[model samples]
Target: MIVKPRLPVINRAHPLAKGLVADYPFFERGGTTLRDISGNNNHGTLTSMDPAVKWILTSQGYGLDFDTTDYVTIPDSDILDFGTSPFFVETWIKTTVNNVRQVAVAKADVTGNFIFEMGTYRTLTANEIYCEFYVSGLYPKVLVVDSSFFDGKVHHLVAGHDGTAVRLFIDGVLRGSNVSAYGNIDTASWAIGTYGAYSPPFRGWNGQIAKTRVWKKAPIAREIATLYADPWALYRSRRGIIGKAVAAAGVTYPQLERSFQRGAFRGIKMGVAA
Candidate 1:
């Protein structure tokens, strides 16, 4: 007889559920300081002369909104440096700007040591993700995602070096791959929403960044698939009260039944705490 392990009935309000904090340097909070939710204490400091960057309430939680000119700066640390190790950066972003390159996450200097950019390549599709992986002595290897990310809806974006090649995942799908790899990506500092202090500061992201996660080890395809399905699952399982309210507010009950039919977590039962 085969027995299946019981999965915890996850509470959507609780982000620190089991196996959720596996990624290091995760930023999901929206506040003056972008605290690292991964419990690594690798928080990022907001840097902007004006109030261009601010926090906003998102469906998942609080998210950071950035103007085309605002960005966040993280101090130089060994944790941010991945030396020839498999690493990945994943985040949720929503944007409509596709005309110019928008840097969602980057680590490099003005001379272009290394950069993992989205909405890259001037005139390139706003939905594409770009990466410029380079070590001190090795030649730079640039890769772009096969898919686009300018859907105007919230979408998951991920880029990483999986020990042998560069990989890109858009909405849980392996959209791009490049065999050319690099050794040790070293940088003094890293920036979010823009390229590292480049002259004139190019590729500043103009969108809402909800969740940002950096992992030292590359996640397998199954893990990535789970991450993608989380939002849909949470909406169904955790919104019991809200879903009922919505149904009551509507004129038709059949619509609600249809919704439940299409919803996720069908058989899993959860009860409110008394």
Candidate 2:
């Protein structure tokens, strides 16, 4: 006789009753509005929001541009209110140049309270991409991705914290985890694209970004998978030219490549003349 393996059962009155149970421990479709940030009808890059700022667009992707003054500012009213517990931040980004300074795109206070930062640093010969989180301190708990892992290509980055430990993700895969001493992000003037008083100030972005989102509660593995699978479903259903190029060429969008190549060539010619 053939028999199926039995699954574990849990009481309905359990504290985790709202989420998936042990028997069916996976989230159903369209549970959260995280996809709505990208919208449901549009594709391509998220050009600009309702309020206009002096952000320089280096490529066609969401969060591709960085404003000199402040890319995005969250007022006290809209600040994500947490109850001294866990939280998560997720976004997809395409890096333009290796070893360049660029924030991972996050919300933070002016003095630096709840912030997520991602950038690259050059060693003797190679470059490493690293992510750090600061709740209320000078130094942060950092997770670094080796140069070989980061190739100036598109990657999905996720940071999750629960007052004691911090975790990092790349392309939906768990990369590294670290322990920290801080918790809860209660700050003012949350900014993205740049940290507080960092060098290469207001330089702006140089690549594409998509499906940027934030959640008040720490997301489980299944939710993270769903976000990675269909990042732009809520914002727009159809893929744009950029998406097509990536699928066919195994590289970034053609237009972005052309822009960078042309710009670099022009710069080289100018330098030779001088």
Name the lDDT value of residue 69 in candidate 1: 76
Superposition error at 174 for model 2 (Å): 0.9
Q: Candidate 2, residue 172: CA error in Å?
A: 0.4
Query: Which stretches of model 2 miss by more than 4 angstroms?
Result: 1-63, 66-70, 112-115, 119-126, 135-138, 148-152, 196-205, 233-274
lDDT of 1 by residue, 1-274 (tens): 1111121233445432323332322222333466654445666777762333376544434467778677777666677677777877777777876566678887777675654554444434434456656644654444453334666666787777888887777788776777765566566567778887574256788887766767677656776776776532322334466446644685232343334345543653322211
How many clashing pairs per prediction, in order? 1, 7
lDDT of 2 at 192: 42
Q: Please give the lDDT score for candidate 2.
A: 0.44
In the predicted model 2, the residue pairs found to clash are 38-235, 39-234, 39-235, 39-236, 40-234, 40-235, 40-236
Q: Which runs of model 1 end up more than 4 angstroms from their true locations?
A: 1-31, 49-53, 123-127, 135-148, 231-274
